[model samples]
Target: MEEKSWSELLAEHSPELAQISRADGEFLDADSALPAWVKQLMAMQMDAVFNHPHGARWYGRRARELGASREQVVEAIKLLRIFGGRPAMATGAEGLREPSE
Candidate 1:
């Protein structure tokens, strides 16, 4: 079976919810003192700490694309270990693994 795009899945579930999510994303993505990459890294850390591995990976990849270094990502994961413990650190590390292109 083919994988469904995020929009497609959201549409199938709830278009209104998807629209709200997009709006919230746009609001959060607005200009700020922090750079885009920093924001992505912050999101990754929060996701990892919350046990949201998929979000952690996605934000980590986005952070890299926005000019964050691997070392930066690793550091963020390490910092989160205090709050999230070993399991969270392990899950966050999944972002380090290359995803299939």
Candidate 2:
């Protein structure tokens, strides 16, 4: 079975809000001075710090796909620990775990 996307799930509950979210995502995803991987990594950090594990995992995967190194991801998590404390670091680490584990 096909899985529903985040936007698709959002759309089921609130179409207008989903549209706005999609537009916002498109705008944020536009090409900029920062590379795609950097943007995705930033998003991953924010999600992890904010306690959105699912979003953190999603963004972390995207960042890796875009060429972010494991070291880079670890450094980001360390930064989170410094700024966002241990809980954030723990959550972010969880997001980095392999699915099989």
Candidate 3:
């Protein structure tokens, strides 16, 4: 199955999401009713994608649009760097920079 945005995934599966399906892959719990949970999820996505060379260009705008603040995005990067080390920190930090004018 295609990877869907958290918002799209949530909308596509609301009441059903509350139940844990045996189907494999990353499925968000229906219990993620809190707005922050959704935001944090999106921010963490940046952490994963930031491993790519151009991950910020790939996931930065979408992350914010998905409700992740700049601070949250940066914080997620910092966390990843702490665990993932320098290279992760370097790439992830790029996500925090505002696009050039």
Best by TM-score: 2
Instruction: For candidate 1, give the lDDT.
Output: 0.83
Candidate order by decreasing TM-score: 2, 1, 3
What would the TM-scores of all predictions be? Answer: 0.64, 0.66, 0.37
Q: Compose the digit string of candidate 2's lDDT tens values, residues 1-101.
A: 99998788999999999999988676546557887788888899899878899999988888788788999989888887787776666888998889999
2 versus 3: better lDDT goes to = 2
Say which candidate scores most in lDDT.
2
Candidate 2, position 52, lDDT: 97
TM-score of 2: 0.66
lDDT of 3 by residue, 2-45 (tens): 88866566657783663333221223322245554354454455
In model 3, the runs with Cα more than 4 Å from the true position are 1-50, 86-101
User: Which lDDT value does model 3 have at 4?
Assistant: 88
Instruction: Give the poorly placed runs of model 1, Cα more than 4 Å off.
Output: 1-6, 28-30, 86-101
Q: Is candidate 1 or candidate 3 better by lDDT?
A: 1
Q: What is the lDDT of candidate 2?
A: 0.84
Candidate 3 residue 83 Cα shift, in angstroms, is 1.3
Residue 13 in model 2: shift from native, Å?
Answer: 5.0
The alpha-carbon lDDT assigned to residue 89 of candidate 3 equals: 71
The per-prediction CA RMSD against the true structure, in angstroms, equals 11.6, 10.7, 12.8
- lDDT, each prediction: 0.83, 0.84, 0.55
